[model samples]
Target: MKHQATPYFTFNGNAGEALDYYKQIFHGEVINLQTFGEADFETPEEMDQRVMHAQFKKDALFFMVSDSFTDQNVKTGSNIALVLECESTDEIQTYYDRLKNDGNVLMELQDTFWGATYAKVKDPYGITWDLNYTKEQ
Candidate 1:
């Protein structure tokens, strides 16, 4: 139930470009990446290549970026998220529903072949988030 500090960026519709720009500006590498169609989340063709999730690291700093998937009115803002790496499905769903109420649900909880219960949302204040429950070995 503990949350780790993470930076989440919600782009109006230019996540890919913005991420790449940041990578270049910071001289960091995009460590992890996920796209809309690449995962369970649906994406419009125009947004397919856009970043669903991307992490850039420059030393100890982690930066995440994603395109708009909530269908809500998106705007510019400098905000961050504290990601939750939950321990179970029930926990994941409970967190998802609770956060979805006052935030933007970008991804509904789904069981992935990668063996994780995962979802993403942006709280009312424009802060993005991600939740995960990894499958046990």
Candidate 2:
């Protein structure tokens, strides 16, 4: 029953600076930093040098940050978006299939290497969504 979307920002190779500045301005806590050079990135030459993801938290607020991949002509202003976490596989799969009708899917819905059901799609509205549903134990 969680409706909150985790906002993921995409910087143009300035994610570290952006996250740091925001942390200072909001007095936030910068948590994990996942760079693109890690094993998750296939084309590290294009993404390895960039920040894959970073977490910033303060008070009741929390968000993530990263850089837009240079391999694609990603829009600067509208590069990032909400990551929706569905409660169930059926819910997420159904939502993903429905959302991808006219949508550009970045990744097909499948079990990720991290052991989670994951998919990404950019809706016609130009908003990128990372839809994730953790496998129920």
TM-score of each model, paired residue for residue: 0.66, 0.84
**Model 1 Cα lDDT, one tens digit per residue, 32-124:** 788876867555776677667788889987767777776665665643456788978888899899889999887787877667888988889
Best by lDDT: 2
- Give a tens-digit lDDT track for model 2, residues 1-137: 25799998888888888987997899888897878887463865766768876889998898888887665555767877889989988889887998899899988999975568989999888888899887766
Per-prediction backbone clash count: 0, 0
Model 2 stretches with alpha carbons more than 4 Å out: none
RMSD of each: 3.7, 2.1
Q: What is the lDDT of candidate 2?
A: 0.82
